[model samples]
Target: MALDKRFIGREYGPFTYTIGAEKLREFALAVGGARPGAGTPGEPPAHVSPLLYDARAAKAGPYFDLIAFPSFAVVFAVRPFSAAIADPELAVNMLMLVHGEQELEFLDVMRPGDVMTTTGRIENIFDKARMSFLVVSSESRNQTGKTVVKGTWTAVIRGG
Candidate 1:
């Protein structure tokens, strides 16, 4: 089955999510980080930082209490993913599914009390010998139009 390329350059809504401290802790523990708080390089500590009061600075460490791990965003909003794959032209090949690469960019930290929305879509698709590479993107935002997280998800699909 061939993938529908129409999704390319398409955009989805700004899905919503709330960052939680426990989620950050769980992500930290899963990553084998003995350090109290460890996050993506160039990112700040997941533990509460001193810059919590400023709206702009507050986005820095939202992962501590507001975000589960980066993967948590998948759970935070799966509908967009489902919608993309469920499309008739997308060809849902579960057995041939393999995660290729994942890129996460945090625009700001989302605090627990805040609400977030995540929008996702199929970005591009590449054809390989007997498989295909699908690029998907999702953006997480607060109600106030602040981007909490942006993610690029790549999936490798095989032939049944």
Candidate 2:
């Protein structure tokens, strides 16, 4: 069965997330190829910037605080996309779904203690070559109401 194109433009929630220094460090280190152990985020690889994991360095750096990796926005920004995929009304077939693509734009760096609110909507729904495509566009704003991130998430369902 084909996905209902009528569901296009359906909006998802304004999910809120608080950024923590530890989580930011963990994410950056892990993505930078660090291995985590009992209590540490592991040794950050040479390519990983100290500003991402060293509090002192970060405190003295340009942002003057721990900064999350650019892609870290996905942590909070993906809520809307996830919600849409799980919406009962949409009836997306989980077994047949696959992430097609993702694009994120970081307007500003994310810092620890920043409260992020994300909202998204189904931007488009279409079918091609026996497949269905679901596109969700999300926007994330900081506590001060500045746009911090924008993301386009795409999901493909086979055998549309």
**Maximum-lDDT candidate:** 2
For candidate 2, lDDT tens digit of each residue in 90-151?
Answer: 99899999999999999999999999999999999999999999999999999999999999
Q: List residue ranges in candidate 2 displaced over 4 A.
A: none
Model 1: per-residue Cα lDDT over 34-102, one tens digit each: 344355222334653333322344455543433344455555655566566656566668676877787
Cα RMSD, each candidate:
7.1, 0.8
Native-to-model Cα distance after best TM-score fit, residue 32 in candidate 2, in Å: 0.6
Q: How much is the lDDT of residue 54 in candidate 2?
A: 95
C-alpha TM-scores of all predictions: 0.64, 0.97
TM-score of 2: 0.97
